[model samples]
Target: MRCAVANTTVMVRKYERMSGRQSWSEEEMAKAVAAVVSGKMGYKLAARTYHIPRSTLQRRASKVRYQQPDDPKPLMGHYRRVFTESQEKDLVGYIKSMEKFFMGVSRRDIRELAFQYAEDNNLNHPFDVNTRMAGEDWVRNFLKRNPELLHKSEKDYELEPVNFDQFYHFMCQSS
Candidate 1:
């Protein structure tokens, strides 16, 4: 089978030669196992041919293969959040509502809100001891985590109802 070798494609029997900590694709691993199972190539030869780790290939070849795991592993290892996901979702809703009313939330307002959320929830957060507000880093990371919470100023076109009424009246009289 043809396999990629660096920038060029090379004609290989079953596996291509690989080095370092390069990750093998699922298809490549399956192909290597297929070669060994069909008695066309031995374990060591298939491993060498496919550029896969000998131990990894041996383990797969020895075991009765099953379907892949259905669940996805968590990206965050030990990192715990100050606020729960539900709380964050609520915060998002609140921010959206405020924006709907043409009220722009500032960074400080977000930090204060986060502090309040944690306090209201009785959560033991790693926030400041004296300031009682969420740290800058926390706010920055929160923005990163919740991309939909994009901070936008109230557009100039969106005037207050009173101002809009006055403008409408002025335009009607002039025209």
Candidate 2:
């Protein structure tokens, strides 16, 4: 099928039914663990009520009971959130608002702004200490993520004065 709005062809695939365990959301995990901890409900009962796996709820409840000092901190295993999700959304909003005033931010400008935001917030960013700027890759990924931000380059053209009448007169005289 062709999608007119997107101007692209969409493929329809047959729906396949697969049996697997469903993933639990943060809220669901917390609620299930809390219910089990409250002593009014058992792990199996709470899991059934929350529509989550009993084993998963049991694991979460155990973790909550025996939480270590470092467990409270956010896990920075793969990627560290230099800015929280809300902060990043705000940054994107600010950049987009600038476009409303005919002001376009370049990739470098965004990088600089990101660095300044991190520094001001004292966030532990992955940017270099010497350069004090976010990486080029980060800027590229940011642009990729926000496709609405168009990169428009303002061009400066040099205008040279030309006399068409003088050229016509010179051509007539020469002929």
C-alpha lDDT score of every prediction, in listed order: 0.67, 0.67
Query: Candidate 2's residue-wise lDDT over 1-175, tens digit each?
Result: 9766756887869866576667568898888888898787898789888888998888888877786443324545875456666778767866664444434555655676688777866776898778767998888877776766655542211132223234323433553
lDDT of 1 by residue, 98-125 (tens): 4565445566656766776677668778
Residue 83 local lDDT, model 1: 66
Superposition error at 172 for model 1 (Å)? 42
RMSD of each: 16.6, 21.0
Error of 2 at 86 (Å): 2.1
Tell me the deviation in Å of residue 64 in model 1.
Answer: 29
